[model samples]
Structure formats: C-alpha cells, structure tokens
Target: MSVNAQPCPGPQPDALVRVDEGAIWRADGKPFDPLQVAHTRHALSAHPLLQLPRLRRLALSLAGTSHVKYALPNRKAGSAFHTFSESEAKMSIASTFDHIEEAGNWVALYFLEDEPEYGALLRDTLDGMKAQIEPRDPGMHGYSLFMFIASPPTVTPFHIDRENNFNVQVMGRKHLRVWQAHDRVAVPDAAIEDYFVHDTLRSLHYHEELDARALDFDIGPGEGVYIPSTAGHYVTTEEGAWALPGGRVSVSLAMTYFTTQTARRARVHLLNAFLRDRFAAAPMPPGKSGLVDHLKQPLAKILIESRMRLYGQAAPRGMSGH
Candidate 1:
C-alpha cells in the first residue's frame, strides 16, 4: 500500500498462478485448442503483488505512459466499441486508483511486462503452462498483460483481439460472453480483414441476438476463462455483489500471447484483404485454404517489411514478421 514500494523483487517461491490439473481440455476431452473457450482457476487473487495497494502503485507508475488507458464506464452492452475514449477521464490518472470505488472509471494497464517485475511474473506464469499450451499452438511470442479495473455496472464493449487471452478475474464478479473466433454470423470476414488491415473496430457491432450464441461465464475471484484469438467477446461487471466494500470495484487481468498459427493467420488475412481490394478476388477466409495460406505468408511478410521501411515504424503487435 506504500506509494514508495520498490520494484517487484526477483522470483519468489510462491507461484502467482495455479491452474488446476486437467482444466485445460475441451468438453469432449479433445486436446486443447488455443482457439477454444476454456475455464481454469488461479491464485492471483491471493498474491501479495496484486493487492490493491501494490496495484495502485503500479497504476501510478504507468500514469504518463502509453501503457495506461482511462475511460468513463459504459453501461450499455451494445454500445459501440469506440464510443468510449481512453483518454477522456473524469479524474486525474494519479488519483483514479485512490478513488476507484466511486470514480465510475474503467482503467486498463496494457503490456505490463514492460515493467521488470511484471515481466518476470508473466514469464513465470506462462512458463508453467508451456507443456499445456505450446503443444497445441507453438512458437508463442508477443507476450503481454492487460489489467482492467473498473467500477461496478461497467461493460467492456464487444470487440475482437488478435492474441489468445487467459482472462483471470481477481476481484468482484464478471459476466463474460464469448462468441467463437470463426463464427461468421457474430463477426464477418470483411470486418476481421478490416481489423487486421486497417486496425479498426468500426465494423464490429454487438447485437442482442448474438448473446444466445455466446459461451457465457460468470466468474469471481480466482476464476478465469480462456478466449481464443480473434474471438468476439464482451464483459459486464456485476453491481451490488456484496463481495468488496461498497460492491463497486472489479479487477481482472488478461494474459495474452501470439502463437505461430495466429501469426500465420494474420499474414493470410493481410493478403486476403489485399486481394479483395485490388482484384475483387473473393479470397477464402484465413485457415480455409492451407495451400493458399502457405503461398500468401511470404508475400505478406514482404509487404509488411516494405511498409515498415517506408514509414520507419515497427510492425504492429501480433503482426511481427514471424
């Protein structure tokens, strides 16, 4: 709780996460696919480093960095993903955490691994699952962490992410609904292509009808869910749960990574979008044609490298030249 807390100490014996044995498989007992929704438990809620005081310090430390985002809470589940701006906050970044319960704020701390202590935590947590996750989706990279702290009655707008996510609930309760990554009805190929090509979420809109098709989870402290790459999902924190003081605060952590398969799919999407625009070619969606995907990977890589050189910018996350 001390504002002068030092950096996270080197690895301690106590584990930050503890996944139950046999908790990573599918309902039919098939081998885990990094793309499927799964449930698991964690010990993070009890970890000293995740206690509010330490987290407050972490939030304070990220005040001026691009790694932190602050926004007013969205109460509507069907709200547009971009309707809320991260830069528009009702409170100062330094004091937001101190008044989290009443601030009605939604704060996200991204890529925490950029901090030394958090990086070690991410590595140790993921290393423990290498045997379970790597066999299914190998060559994992782009390791990142997203910590979300919000006031009650907040909704995380429906959207898709490029990396596979292990969203663990550390405090309060959350009702999460996730549509399958390949469900075209929930998310069309054109929208996905636009996201990969232009980095836009304009095409991803949530409708009430999509809720019936979602895989839902109501999680609390120590509980977590796995969401696949590009899966469309949203979250709503419960109001008046009576778990914490004032029943007004909720916290969760998303541990995400990119795999070899995800990287390949991104390249394929890039090529498909190009073909669709340039030649009016109705290219198949990613993973639909293995041969075509193999052919496009190299071409996409060339294009990405050329663009980076032209603009003097690094390739975006999840689109690294893998």
Candidate 2:
C-alpha cells in the first residue's frame, strides 16, 4: 500500500466544484438504460418500510431527519444523545454529521422514500427513463466477487459499511475520495483492538492525504463510483445552479453485496475481537498464547453470526439513540 508514501497533491475536487451542474438529470451517456435502472429501483423500493428509495433522497433524509432511530446496545461505545426539539440549539449536528462536515456544509432531513416529493420523482424517473447503472468501478474494486445491492448519494466522511458497497450515481452525482486500509489512512481496527477497546468497528480519518487524485471523480448526475470494504472515502453534494431547477439533490443508491472483500474484513475484525475478549477475561499463559491466536479465525465466524442476530428490526431494542 503506497498510500502513505508521498502526499498526492493537485486541486481537490470539493474545493473547486460546488454548485450543481446544469442539465443534471438530462445526462447524455447510456451505460445502462435509464428506464431499466428506474424499473429495478422501483421494484426494490416498492417496500413501504424503506425510508429512502432514491439514493440521493435517502442520504438527504439521513442528514435532515431529526428523529433518532434506536441504537443497538452493542453499538459504538459512546452513547451520547439529545432530546428532539424544534427549538433546541444544534447539539447533535456536531456529532451526527461531524465526519461529513470535515469536507463541507451539511443539512439532514427525515423524509421517507414514500414521501410525495421524493417518491413521486423516483417513480416517474424510473418509469420514464431506461437507465442502467454500472455496478462497481471494477478498476477500483476487482477484489470482490458479488453483485451490489443498493446505491445511495451520501455526504460520507471517513466511515465503514455493514457490507461492501459500490455506490452508483443515477441522475445526480456525488464524489468519492478513497483511502486504503494501511497506515496512511486512519485504521480503525488497530485503534479498536489496541487503544480504544471498542468491539464494534468504526472508521477514523487521517486527512493527511491531500492529493486530488487520492479523491477521484469530479462527477455529475449520471456517473458511478466504486468502493470496497474498509476502503475509506468522503462525500459531498454539489447543488445545481441558479436557473436549472433544483440543486444536485443527487439520485444515487448503495450497490451493496456480501463480497469476499467484506468477508475478509469481517473475519479479521472478528478474530481481533475474539482475541481481545479472551485476553481481557483471562490473560493467556506463555505456552497457550500461540494456541489462542491460531484459533481466532474459526472462532471469528461464530462471533460474527452472534452479533448480526442482535441487529434485526424485528429483534428487541438493545440500544437507545438518546
């Protein structure tokens, strides 16, 4: 991983490109039939429970939604929260979108995909345009062998995902500036296993890399970008200009898949957790240290399955958002 070797430098995209592009939805290229893309999206998003159908809408809602979903008890160690209020000072803003704010300004809303404004747009677009989305940018993500699940437009800043995601831009666009899982980028697992002692793995950022190339894609509405598990990246929305209707309320989706890459990342983290738990409960003896480390891989699978069971919506609430 030559990530930390020399700071790749040019002009970063975020600073240069701000306002939304003109003729945003009216993109020229046709990698996939826009109509097809919309049909697929409509079929998948027909589920009423899905908060956000169009990726862009979902991301915005995540940003704008004031109501906090209950957090799993086993969620991140720091469980600080704020009481929902229209008149309250910006309390969670600093923590909620802290990762994204490192790059630019942010605002979140709580609108479901079924909402009239967003859902109607999504349904109309899907029904009209025969759009096809490029699943994952294979150039960046040849490591995994799996199909993507969803694509969402998110102002992401230094975070990991539950599964491997190759985010594709359908109508509007957002950019992805990725960091490798090596020393140059802030490695969460190392910090978690050693200093932090947090079992649930989360992302950390080392904004040391300033190269424009490091953060690729000065993309517009109708573009696609790829990402792998443990591959760190940041996102920011570029609103449309003054005349051309709405800003780049990017229409994107999370093309999720259970890939080999995700499995590897998961396995490694699970192994680390198992080792940490074992050591914390009872320190290993000199002769048993080798045996304990060797058993970590198989033991890791057991640990991952147990944790997944804790997160289903049907399951009882384990952690509170407040």
Candidate 3:
C-alpha cells in the first residue's frame, strides 16, 4: 500500500485506539490515572499501514535518517544495548528486512509523526485518548511514535524513558516486565538525573532480583499496556510466538507523550544534576519535597534556557529531558 492509502476503503473517521469499559483503571480502583499502568486495546494491529511490506517501505524511506536505528539482537536479557554500525551490517536495509526473521536484528523507526501517513494515524490515536489523558496529565506534548521490529529470541534492554508510553503489540507475542515509575530501587535518582543531563543509559543496569517487583505481561496482537514515565521495563520476544507463518518477527509500537507534570519533573531533575555535579550539593530528588521542588522548577528552567542559548542545544522533547 502507498503511504497515503487508508487502512480501509471509503471515508470514515479513524479511531485507532479502543478503550472499552474498565479497560483503563488503576489497581487502587480509582478513576483513570495516566501515571499508572493500564492495559488497553487498539485497532492499529490490523491497520494496513503497519503490515510488513509497508513497514519495509517506511524503513527504506527512513534509511540513512537519524530516525531509523538498527541493532544486533541480544539473546541475553541482561546484555547492554548498542546500535549496529554500518560495518557490522553489510546488507541493505531492505535485505535486512527480508532476512529479519533469522538475521538476529532489531530495527526501530522513530518519530513516525514526521512521516505523512503514520503522522495522521498517530494523531488520530492520540486524539482518541485526549479525554482520558488530559484530565489526569494535562498539557500533553512532544508526541512520538516509535515502531520496533525485532526477531524472536531478542531482548530490548531494561531501561527507563522520559515520556508516558502506550505500547501496542502489532504482531507476535512478547513478554514484558515493568516496574513502577517511582520505584527508586529499580532506578536510582542519580541515574535518572544523569539521563536528563547527558542523554546516556550507561548508569541504568538491570539485575535479575528486580523481577520480583515487576508487573509482567505476555501480550499479542491487538493487546497493549500503558507504561508511566521513568518506569523501568524490558521486553523479550520468544522464539515460538510468531503471529505470521514464515518467521518469528515481532512488531510493536510505542506512542509516547509528555505532560505538564513530566515537564516539571524534567526540569527538577536537570537542576538536581547540576547541583550534584557542579556545586557538590545533594539535592532532594524530584517530588520528594513540595516546597523545595517548587523553588527549583523555575531556576531549572532558567538554567536550561541559558544552556540552550549558550550551547545551541535544544531541550529534550516537551522541553523536558526524557
């Protein structure tokens, strides 16, 4: 299908996400909370645009672009994450896609909103969730859609992200384990601050012991889960759960956005990092002290803006380092 082709024939308003009654609720049985983990269902798994051929075309279009990343598959769940160099993959992207099932590769297409058709689909999906998201986490921005296509027996390294994510499985089945967003034991405050400051994941390490505290989900096509910002998580696609007949290639998409609360938290973390690194001050972690957090927010913003002006470095999406 062409990039502009609609999933179905005829003119109809697209509603990519489907949240049935009780589809979104916290464990405490409170009203819908965006910051908490919630299982959801979506129509994108059946969307024509996400089919392998169309995705291969998208990958070709994104070739040599920063938005596309290729990695060698990690068989061990605890292995560190790294990108594949040009020398490491001596094949064209199309060829890689052709052999993806047995190539032991993982490909990611980021910022799908920048593309024409995917952008429209992403917008519709997010718009469908506005009523549920806005009331809980207002001012959502920096919308991003990341598509991951990986071979079976591969693992996405355990790590934390800055934006709240709605991850949907498009094909195959994968085991997902997620920890709480505020679980400092899984991810330390210092590591989070370092991520915002340096854009690195070197400090975040995974240990098998963390499994005891994880909420695990084994999901297939049309199934999904909501993961709060900074939630430590990892995914593994098993060898036998391929949805298609030929190969065990797993496809998934992560739709992420930043809210007002996330923006504030980013600034606070940036400020804390500065204090710890430059001033030898051990500032309280974000959300730890209300008054102190409020006091640090503006100062952090000023610091970030000044740095941007002086260094020509744009702040992370939503102006929050995530």
Best by TM-score: 1
lDDT of each: 0.75, 0.35, 0.75
lDDT of 3 by residue, 249-303 (tens): 8888998888888888888889889999999988898778888888987799889
For model 2, what is the error of residue 293's alpha carbon versus the real structure, in angstroms, after optimal superposition? 11
Candidate 1 regions with alpha-carbon error over 4 angstroms = 1-31, 83-87, 243-247
Q: Pull out the clashing pairs in model 3.
A: none
- Which lDDT value does model 2 have at 15? 30
TM-score of every candidate relative to the true structure: 0.87, 0.43, 0.86
Model 1, range 1-322, lDDT digits (tens) per residue? 0011111122233454443333223323455677777765655666666767889988887777778776545457667664322355445566777678763567888889889887877777776667778887898788898899887778888899988898877776677888988898998887888898888988887899988888887777667778898899998876755464435778889988888899999888887888899999888888877898888888988878887899876766687746
Error of 2 at 247 (Å): 4.2
Candidate 3's TM-score reads: 0.86
Total backbone collisions for each predicted model: 0, 38, 0
Candidate 1: residue 3 lDDT (0-100): 15
TM-score of 2: 0.43
Consecutive 10-residue window with the lowest summed lDDT within model 1? 1-10
